[model samples]
Target: MPGTTPDPRSPHRGRAVRGMFASIAPRYDRLNRLLSMGLDQRWRAALVRSLPELVPGQRVLDLCAGTGDVAQALHGALPSGTVLHASDFCEEMLKRTPAKFEPGAAPRLTVGDAMALPYADQGFQAISVAFGLRNIESPQVGLAEMARVLAPGGRLLILEFSRPERKIFSAFYRFYFFRILPLMGRLLSGSEIDAYRYLPESVWAFPSPAEIGREMEQVGLVVREQRRFLMGAVVLHVADRVAR
Candidate 1:
């Protein structure tokens, strides 16, 4: 995440990270659609449908809210007076989204760090991260920070790509992920970015669903449920921060 050479030790170099995302921000949406063949929207929809812990009028935070994908849909689900706070560290990426929100887009976009969210303890009723945890230096610290912002009995929904269970499918997916996806990303993004290449690699390197749930439990968040899809190639993990 530093310069063109990757530093294995710390992947989340703030300024450098911003430039990386900004470099690809323009083609981000188009590439997501083309590469995933529109499965990205399906994944976002699944996140919305699977999110059961957020009540109608509760305040919620969308961590690493890239271009208002989750935030826009989430705003529709909330009742009157419900608040949607979307934040990301990359200003250029955020700017790509409409500066003035669309009708019913109740989001308040802000530039903020995920590992150190700008909110008091128990400030939100629900917190969610979609396709963002892998970018963090310490996902545990980010998760703990999210839990810290949740109110009593609040829940967290994390949607992320995972390692596929089927060997053959995993191999094929790997081919598409490592080879095809990155090729298309480079072609469309018009830059020599290895971000898409890292996507598949990171998914393979990331902890399994059970491991993530255990991490949540360790952080004092009770893991209530988990749903894995595409032979475990993707997972939506849910947990709660109960009142002490």
Candidate 2:
């Protein structure tokens, strides 16, 4: 039962997520679009939609910024004058970032660990980590870092793959996710971690909505709402840093 997967005691259980992405960064975007059938763009747009609630001209942070997809999406979705800071630990992953941002938007890209963000306390109005938080080796520290960096009343938006609630859809998702995805990943990325194998594995290992809500609340982030999409196979978790 070793590879069967241990229960998720913390959100920071795997580094394979990072290693897998870095290894396949060259073809990451293409394969993502192909595998998700282009719905990933709409998912990022849904993540972008969360931006309007924040005050106009607010400061934004995109953690685990991998190629700046969320950052670029936010730049287009938010009001003008939003200060955007995008950060990722992998140099190879970040190398593809600038090209994704708007022409001349000049997003600040930093090579830094998510657990130890190099920024002043309470510095950002909104922080987003799309499909990236579950990969951190120390998610408690990473979540704490997000909390530490958020200004009073700032929002933390999280986008992640989730288990569908309905039994029928869950069965269908498992078939596609487990049986089909790994084969497609091998054909596309040529990754060694069985990258697609790790995808469903990580999603299964990730905390449920209630579990994540409790963890965020423990860190003083109030669980605001959860927008479930794709029959709950994906979730957008919205939390707000409490105003002091």
Candidate 3:
């Protein structure tokens, strides 16, 4: 099972994913910066910018908020009174979030599962997940929970790794992604877990943007827009919660 891809529906998938992330927690931020050549930050900013205009005191949640990068961006972009929350199932990853912000400026960090978020219904005006959805045990269940917590008309911005469409570029992308990236990740993070190897596998296994849009619709969210970057190697899906 050294190179085996994790099945999202496997009963043990969540535990496996959590452990993998936990092992990489310390180097997660650094690895992200290196792996994406800092484009990850720009992608996260795009996700924040895609949010619909939110009123003061409205809430936003950054689900699967690894090290609170997106949550920090949300805090800076939102109005003064907006409440921002960052949640991740892996406590180790959440533990590193506070250092990213000045004393109290950090988004409220919570250790919670995406599939069964702790918040009440319709609580968030917006929710963002950056490159995290593919790690979920069941992305549909995760999206449903996101929809459940989103206030009517609230938006959900998903920035995730997507396949490149151009033939030549895609071949090069795969060579780097599958062959080079994982080796670099393993060497740089010094993690025993196959976290880097898992990355490409998860992204490759993830649903296409069109399929994801349909999944969003099934969960009461309407796809509003999609923007592709890095020659479609990454995508931002902007969706809104439909009133019941």
Candidate 4:
């Protein structure tokens, strides 16, 4: 059903989302590049660029890391002594992350739920989620969890899909997002679950950037900056954990 908002607390919704990603795991990276016209990586790079400088031995977490694209990018950008962690609930998607690196070079990969992350409090100096927050069963719970693990003054970056402000461009983008993109996804990934169809629907149902910023503030994070790409079709939110 078009315009239907997902019920985040539904148990069935979690299982369905997990199943959808697992089914598309094989061609996930390929489909992303094709569907986004290779702009995804650039968007991630922008996220990385927004990070605050870190001292040696400080840690970073890439939550809901599918195939470790953001983790790999962070690995290259971080100081030599810094550690990086990559986590996702789907093992099938996470298992592919190591192949993107040489022996012993990949970020520590963990199969864990975003809402109930398996980590200690104040553990990470920085955290990032790329196009994954909206997929969480409860994005607010996920944000709180992220805040719990973040050190005071730690930064969090969120790269996600957003609606364009320009009316004419938004209409064209919606036509492609809701209609054409899913067709390409089904053709390319051969996914029976219609994962790509879920993509636009999720985006449409997601909160606006300002709303998300307010949510962050409620969870002990302060919005620092927001950078939009693809003419507001995508947005990167930069925030910091409030010092306790």
Candidate 5:
């Protein structure tokens, strides 16, 4: 299970996804700030604040750690002696991580896949993955792997786009997300591909918070909280690995 790759026959599959991220790696952070109108920063900040306090020697893993934003935030929040590790399948994205996040006490960075994490069972005390679950080849497999690497009672935080509950706002948000945002991202990132286009489609296809909660439960993670921001356009799902 740890080494399994996504189905090759799936259209716009994992390889395409990886290429798209690599193509847009340089402008990814800028587009995030611009497209989200800086709310992305606040969302991540809230997640950092919500994490269980870390003791010295504790380990936190930031999976799908694009550009190291969450990793940087966790590093800042954790005490000096705790270990912070960040991993991403896209080496380009990992390379683009700003040096400011990894000063003297740098977080260990690894190029890894979420569906097949290369860690022992219960290896981490806290794990966070932001805005990248939708890109995984199999979100269920990814979720299960998150449960696998987490210690008993460990925290798991997932930040991702979600459907708005309100009807009128949902319609408008869909228009902007499917049409306007893609155009803007295409122009800014200067990528001929459909990275921006794929983003909304993936998010739209992603399971709702409730469904995700059930999947987490199936993987032995208890849903501790589900917080919606920007009127449910974004969701932060927090869970705890159940002690066996």
Candidate 6:
């Protein structure tokens, strides 16, 4: 997002965010497990569980697939006839995904940006993003694009970090997030771009769950359910595109 043509709405300029992610791709998953105490995996599982039941041959898209965790999970959970596609803007991150799926059931992987997705209108029955929306330059536009690609009454699942609700817990979480996590991330990834620091900054700056629900509604998606985890440090939002 850092190096692209200047857009006032995006938080990271084009290339800057992408470059940071690319730099850390090797150790990203390891660092995530260490930092979140492996809760990240459970959070992802929660996202999968929150989805509406899918029929055979239905299509689903996992944006910001990030080494294919969500994609793999979706592939495993959905009916055998369902189709899953995993996409991300960072090729290095995409490259980190392993060839673990059965030959025929592997998800179709693509390198693409979220703000301007390459999909056609009403192409998918469900779209999901996990912990990646905050990294986008303009989340509002990203959400709109996601809604655009979903069929009428299609599901949208988002699992993202959020501010903690408790005062004492919030203070402690901030201390660890801002102070401790960055150092660990740097040691793990060996990147000098302060990538981990950006994590907290972005989460703090991003819209709250309520605000995000409103944003979804603005783009013709209605929030159907919301769930919080890890004492409100993370949230899952399930929305449905308005039927025509």
Q: Give TM per candidate.
A: 0.91, 0.91, 0.95, 0.95, 0.93, 0.94
Candidate 5 regions with alpha-carbon error over 4 angstroms = 1-12
Cα lDDT listed for each candidate: 0.78, 0.82, 0.88, 0.89, 0.85, 0.85
Query: What TM-score does candidate 3 reach?
Result: 0.95
Residues 40-99, candidate 6: write the lDDT tens digits.
Answer: 889999999877778888889999998888887777789868888889999989866656
lDDT of 1 by residue, 65-103 (tens): 887778876766666677888899888777655544665
Tens digits of per-residue lDDT, candidate 2, 106-193, equal 5789988898899999989999999887777766678889999998899999999889999998999999999999899978785665
- Which parts of model 6 have CA positions greater than 4 angstroms off? 1-12
- Residue pairs with backbone overlap in model 1: none
Error of 3 at 205 (Å): 0.8
* Candidate 3: C-alpha lDDT: 0.88
Candidate 2 wrong stretches, greater than 4 Å: 1-16, 52-57
Error of 6 at 192 (Å): 1.8
- Model 4 lDDT per residue over 95-173, tens place: 9999998899999989999999999999999999999999998899999999999999899999999888899999999
What TM-score, to 2 decimals, does candidate 5 have? 0.93
Tens-digit lDDT string for candidate 3 (106-223): 8888999999999999999999999888888889999999999999989999999989999999999999999999899879886777788888888888899999999999999999
TM-score of 2: 0.91
Arrange candidates by TM-score, descending: 3, 4, 6, 5, 1, 2
